[model samples]
Target: MKYTVLSLFPEIIDAYFASSIMAKAVSRGIVEYRPVNIRDFALDKHKTCDDAPYGGGAGMLMLPEPLGRALESAGARQRFVESAGAGSAGRSSGRVIYLSPGGRPFTQDVAVELSREAELILLCGRYEGIDQRIIDTYVDDEISVGDYVLSSGEVAALALIDATYRLVDRVITAESLEEESFSGGLLEYPQYTRPEIYDTLRVPELLLSGHHENIRRWRLRKRVEKTLALRPDLIRRGEEIGLFDGETRKLIQELGGEG
Candidate 1:
């Protein structure tokens, strides 16, 4: 899929696009990135994109004009479809997401939802934030990566891209996505490789045992145990959503947990 990052700091986002899976994806044309500098669309000689906030604020607010015009001229929808090898999705009405502190909390489900879209434009807010006019005019959704604030949205945008891109068809193995954390409504069980023994701790015996059935049972138990101990909320929510089977229900009861 095509990812258009509207940022004042395009360099920060560009640096990451050149390496690892993203780099390879770009080369293969499986995914593409276009980082538009908000300032590039500025009309004045200074090419300014921010100004002191009206009504009094500590930091400057990004202007609406440059960002809006940049998104319009850059053909946000066209680039995103071509990047994903999906061809041009006419008029790219997919999603225009704004990254901000007050946005809806992001989740694995959200990532999965976004991966299905043909195109996405992420607005990276800076300083205090972007002008409200920009958000009202173009934003499809507002999403926050986490509770705490970061210095810039560039990092958040990269993270969102990595999570969403890997879910695209052929970007990574389907089985790999299936095994990742949160894939099954529970965290993944521990994985081990190479040296059988690390320091004094050995790999779990069940993982090494040749009995596939027994190993599967062991992994399921561990996944339930770990989720119960660390993220009981997930289990509760999972059960509410009809994700738990009789076997899993019995397991939870055996562990002195409800639902």
Candidate 2:
């Protein structure tokens, strides 16, 4: 998938795309990224991109003109015009996303859905945020990484890119994706490494037994136990949505009884 990010600080987005797993993904052509500097589109001598809100606000808001031009440069179109049967001349087809605290919550499910897209256009707002007209005309979705507020939109954008990119085809193995926390409606089971004994603790006996079936059962039980203790909401949601099988439900009942 290709990501076209519009940010005032392209360096922040560039650094992430050049490091670690993302660098490898780019090298293999499994993903691509383009960071467009929003300030570059500013027309004024000072290249100012923010201004005080018309109705009064705590902080300045990002000006719409520069941001709108930046979005157009990244191949975004006014949705109202598009809906009115405007031609697609010079426009790139991609989902336009705005990162904001007021947006829909970002989740594993949302990441999975975005991974299927051929291209994505991400707008990283600054100051108070980009003008609402920009959102109404160009954005397809607004996503929040979490419930909390953040000062920098670039941080939120990077969080989103990291989550979705790893799920892309060939970026990582399918097995690696499986059994992850939230994949099976429960947190992942604890893992152990070599040196079976560590400061008086030993690897689980079932794991050392080399009995695959028994090991799988043990892991499932641990997963249930961990989720119930840490995030029982997941268990309840799973049950409500019928995400668990008979065996899993039985385990939850047994564990709940023990508790």
Candidate 3:
């Protein structure tokens, strides 16, 4: 996968791509991170890119001109190109996704969808927000990480990248990916490592037994338990989607249908 991030603060997201799993992915040619500074496209010597809102607002609105140049220069007309085919998350159309608080809630499903794209152009709006014309003319979708607001779109863009990039080919192993939190429509079970006994507490005997079936069952039950306790909403969603199996149903019943 290839990522093109348009941000006034390119440095904010650039350092992240240069380290950790992302860096390794880049080294292996699994993905590429291209951050385009919007300021560079500013026509003025002072590089002004924002101005006061027309009807009056608390903050400035990003200008349409520099943004137009940046988006156009980033292959806005190509719409994914013959080589890429950057499908719309998973649909037929290619897209430029803008990160904003008003957008649809982003989820694991969205991450899974975006993993298939050949290229992704992420727009990180600053000041109040980008001009609506730019969005109407060039953007394909808007995504929000949550209901809360942030200082700008750059932080949210990093979050979206972090979630989706791991799903890209070879960025992580299938088994590892499958075991992560939210993979099974529930939070992951607790994890353990060395120091079988820590702070006078010993690792679970079942984990030490090396019984794969028992361990798997234990993990599943723990997943259910944790979801019930911390995020019953996920359990409700799982039920609505029929994600739970007979065993999970039995487990919930065993717990008296309570968290």
How much does each candidate deviate from the true structure in C-alpha RMSD? 5.9, 2.4, 4.8
lDDT of 2 by residue, 1-259 (tens): 9999999888999999999999999999999999899889998989999999989869999999999999999989877665566653344589999999999999999999998999999999887888899998889999999999898999999999999999998999999989999988989999999999999999887788989999989989999999999999889889888899888899999999222
For model 2 the local lDDT of residue 101 reads 97
Native RMSD of candidate 1 (Å): 5.9
Q: Give the TM-score of candidate 1.
A: 0.91
lDDT ranking, best first: 2, 3, 1
lDDT of 1 by residue, 109-227 (tens): 99999999877888898888899877766677899999989879888888788889989998878888775678678878778996999999998887888899998777778788888
Q: Cα miss at 193, model 2 (Å)?
A: 0.6
List the candidates ranked by TM-score, beginning with the highest: 2, 3, 1
Off by over 4 Å in 1: 76-91
Backbone clash pairs in model 3 (N, Cα, C under 3 Å; residues 3+ apart or in different chains), count: 0
Task: Give all TM-scores, in the order shown.
Answer: 0.91, 0.94, 0.92
Which residue ranges in model 3 land beyond 4 Å of their true spot?
78-94
Q: On residues 14-60, what C-alpha lDDT tens digit does candidate 3 reach at each position?
A: 89999988999999999888888999999999999999989986999
How far residue 38's Cα lies from its native spot in candidate 3, in Å, is 0.6
- Candidate lDDT (C-alpha), each: 0.83, 0.90, 0.86
